[model samples]
Target: MSAFGKDGVTGLYETHLPVARLERAIDFYENRLGLERAYTNDERRVAFFWVGGKQSGMLGLWETGTAPLGMRLHFAFHASEEWLLDGCSRLRDAGISPLGFHGEAVEEPVVIGWVPAMMLYFKDPDGHSLEALHVLPQPPDRAFGIRSLTAWRQYAS
Candidate 1:
């Protein structure tokens, strides 16, 4: 059995991203995206939500401070390839041009060695880089037209 036990799906959790306006961010995730509210700690300044069947926990909002410029840290969620592509499409429709690692559209999905998963990354409304990934590659025997990092680099070269 791999690290995640027999089925290999371990516990996946979420981390809070600091925001300036709690209400606005909550509105974005809760109303616009229709995520279900899981819980909130008003005095402690935290709110949790469930998006796409996953518990997207506490999004911390620092009411007074402004977010730093170029906030590189981001939060990610697991999604299907279709959802990933659709997210890209949504960004495009919203007039946000997302560039892949190589500054191009993610022409195809890829598995990052660091995370050992197939992923596509993009930014959120705050320019925070976010990723939607599968925990593992589609079985090698399956024909998803996917490629490993080395393979794509070598093929391009």
Candidate 2:
């Protein structure tokens, strides 16, 4: 018999990102973005945060000082539209700007034209791009295919 679930596989376990400084990155994620720091190790210079709450999701930040400047990465967390708006405000209140899907600074989350989701993109202090996402209900009329991020709200229409 299978030791795991009835299905073949399971969900994602965790995600990791690299940063330049451990302390600053901690502040950016814990204080600025509201993630709870779950663990840290100085010898490894790594920190882990509970993304949605304790044991719900995991994010790891590893300090690597020798990487090239302007290194970029992307990560997304599931959120509601209300949370997305409030999150944008939180970033603004911290003097950080929110970004549209195309990477342009914006005041609100963009409704991706192709997918059934809304997204707000921004970067952490280490320049790793992040997204706050809200998946929408599928239209009852018909199905759609992958499309561009812009005007995603109208895909089902």
Which candidate should be chosen as best, given lDDT against the real structure? 2
Q: Give the local distance difference test score of model 1.
A: 0.56
RMSD of each: 6.1, 3.9
Q: What lDDT score belongs to each candidate, Candidate 1 first? A: 0.56, 0.77
Write one digit per residue (lDDT tens) for candidate 2, span 104-152: 8776666653456777788898888888888767543224443333345
For each candidate, what TM-score against the reference? 0.57, 0.79
The C-alpha local distance difference test score for the whole of candidate 2 amounts to 0.77
86-117, model 1: which lDDT tens digit per residue? 65565555554545554457545565544455
Which regions of candidate 1 are displaced past 4 Å? 1-9, 31-34, 54-72, 94-97, 102-116, 135-157
